[model samples]
Target: MTTFLLFSFLQLAQPSAIQFTNQDLQLESNSGYIQLDWTAVEGSQYILQRSMQPDFTNSHTIYQGPDHASFVSGLDNGTYYYRVGDDEGHWSDTLTLKVEHQSMPLALTLFGLGFVVFAFTVFVVIKGVYTTSQS
Candidate 1:
């Protein structure tokens, strides 16, 4: 079938190497969310794998795509291993991460809100100046 031939061709065309940059990992809201990000690969798809054990015998796929990153949500406080690979079976270096629950300190939250207000005020002032100059 035509679909079969196309699939074969794509398999052959898959690259052997996929490099990732700008790798970032974060846990939001006390291990409630696991957000993973990486630099996009130039010409390859990504297969994201995860395992609870370091040995990875119980690994499971989190995603597969060319997007180069994924977020694994609803993970409890624990350690996890991750890796990204190309369709050709070439894999980048492995990464290990731990998610920990964190409570938002009231002081920090207030400070962040203050910063947002200050930024909005500055933006309004700049916009007013620009409009006046244009007129």
Candidate 2:
């Protein structure tokens, strides 16, 4: 049947491998997320896996879809490994991700300093306005 032949042709178009566009990534100290992208094949489904080990023995499947990109977020500070593959078991080179968030105390200190500056600015602005109205 025509439908059977079309399916056979699509199967024959299976790509030999999948390649991620990015090299190993290191997130900024305050960033917790990034977007992952890879080359895609039409009519083919891809799988993205993440692991703590280079061998991917304890890997987790993070995405399975036909899209070429996925958004990854909310990761704690650590190192991670990732790989992409098609339904035909063709996998690309492994990519590494390193996440290091800013320390809580340092972040709080910066926030407090900003608040102080803002309060001072507001006070100065109000005092200027009051003096100008009285003049």
Candidate 3:
């Protein structure tokens, strides 16, 4: 009887593991930003951490709240690692986010070059027409 009681107490004292409703987390990328979404336990405070290293040795907490989704922006093009943990210290699986932001300066330069070419073509065609009419 004592052995049974001890086993029951031990089982009750064991910490329960935190689980996410979706095992496979989804990552969405937008221009200049990335969004992380997951189905988590309601009313639970979670700590969101990010690191440039996959091992997460230098990870830092970006957010600590009850929200199950987070948005991160203004990050340079690179791979980032993220993980979430509850207040009880149970951590979720690590998620990898790869960012590839388009170069704004390059885009602007291409647009400007295209506009100049178009304007030059239109001017040449108009000049040729005017000269032929004069002739």
Maximum-TM-score candidate: 2
- How good is model 3 by TM-score? 0.60
**RMSD, one per candidate, in order:** 10.7, 5.2, 7.5
Least accurate 10 contiguous residues by lDDT in model 1:
19-28
- What is the Cα-based lDDT of residue 88 in candidate 2? 78
Instruction: For each of the candidates, give the backbone clash count.
Output: 2, 0, 0
Taking the tens digit of each residue's C-alpha lDDT, what string does model 2 give over 70-131? 99999889888888998878898888888888999999999999999999999999999999
- Model 2, residue 104: displacement in angstroms? 2.7
Q: Which model, 1 or 2, shows the larger lDDT? A: 2
lDDT of 3 by residue, 6-45 (tens): 9999987875554444445544343657666655766778
Which should have the higher lDDT, number 1 or number 3? 3
Best by lDDT: 2
> Ten residues in a row with the worst lDDT in model 2?
23-32
Output the TM-score of candidate 2.
0.78
Count clashing pairs, candidate 1: 2
Q: What 10-residue stretch in candidate 3 is worst by lDDT?
A: 19-28
